[model samples]
Target: MSAGTSQETPATARGGLFVTFEGIDGSGKSTQCRMLADTLRARGLDVVLTREPGGSDGAEEIRRLVLEGDPDRWSAETELLLFTAARRDHLERRILPALAAGQVVVCDRFADSTRMYQGLSRGDLRASVDQLHRLMIGHEPDLTILIDMDPAKGLARAKGRQGSEERFEDFGLDLQQRMRAGFLALAQEFANRFRVIDGDRPMDVVAQDVLDVVAAALPERDGDAGA
Candidate 1:
């Protein structure tokens, strides 16, 4: 792992797990992320639930700047820079600490979001995005749960939600379609650490699949794996 992307202490080495959820908007990954965290905690595990662009104090401030403004407020490159800065702060202030304390850190989104977003928004900047990550943020989650869903449905779900954070969500179906493909490709590229969950099922079913993936990856303490 690169210095900028590494946890203060390796999560596995410290009995912690860092898991991230990624998907196009309305993929239900957010709900599943929370559900998984709750399930883990109920099983007697320490769990920290956080989200990208706004996990740590500093990152939250950056999130406001990135998510609340006009869509074109910042150029693609500048926006990616802002995201990287926020991610760095999130790692240093919240995520890394939780992992060092042996807590499962479940992030709603991580570096992969940047990779896909920029790849879709500013197609030519994908290389820059990867380079920046390599130079300043070089860590991968123990597992990434990609809630795969149809873009049209995902877009409708995102638009139906009430939020001022529609900057990304407002990109519409076409972009969401591309993002879905990007995430699937990413899953293939990082198959060892990626779980592509079919999210078209009922919420309960989706949540259970997510739980199963996580439980299998990080067996619970004592006899709690099935808990």
Candidate 2:
């Protein structure tokens, strides 16, 4: 929370909506991000569905390195730099372009994830996270949807995915619990843009709740006079 002072969107910004989904691992934010993008596109809105650490080509390369290796493959400091580099590429090539063109940007994860994963989990590097963010990435999402879920359930779901990106999940339940608390605290820290949603419900029900929240926040475009 940069103490309530933030640089407004870069001048090229039109009335674009930058939406990012964030939560503890397996909170189903990725699903909701997809659903929201599809729903908004159905309404004839130009929505750019993207994800951090892997949105653009360069970032996607970085993703393979950070997410596929062992949990301890990189130290927290090194991981932070790698993630920031990826995000910078993502914002430069994908997110910012879409926003400048007045398109909706729906991202699976963003800086907030790093703020917790690296900022708190390994050590107290939160100030470093904030400082780096302010210096490198000066923008925040217009809306951030946090799907809250019990760490135990979330961890089970994450491990069940059995994907190559298990590096983070491999850190175990303790890390998930800490991340859950960190995310919730972040919601308080950035109350203006954070909307917490219960992720324990049926997927469809939770999706609807997410949709309703986003539909309200989105600015009415010419073709999207109503969501």
Q: How does each model score on TM-score?
A: 0.92, 0.94
Task: Report lDDT per candidate.
Answer: 0.84, 0.86
Return the TM-score for candidate 1, rounded to 2 decimals. 0.92
lDDT of 1 by residue, 103-187 (tens): 8899999988998887455466777887788778767788899999999999899889979998877767778988999899888
- For model 2, the local distance difference test gives 0.86
The residue-by-residue lDDT of candidate 2 on 1-227, one tens digit each, is 56246564532255688989999889988888898888888878888999877999999999999999888899999999999999999989988878888888899999899999989997788888888888888888888999999999999999999888999999999999999999999999889889999999998999889888877877655444344
Name the best candidate (by lDDT): 2
Which residues of candidate 1, in runs, are more than 4 Å off? 1-10, 219-223
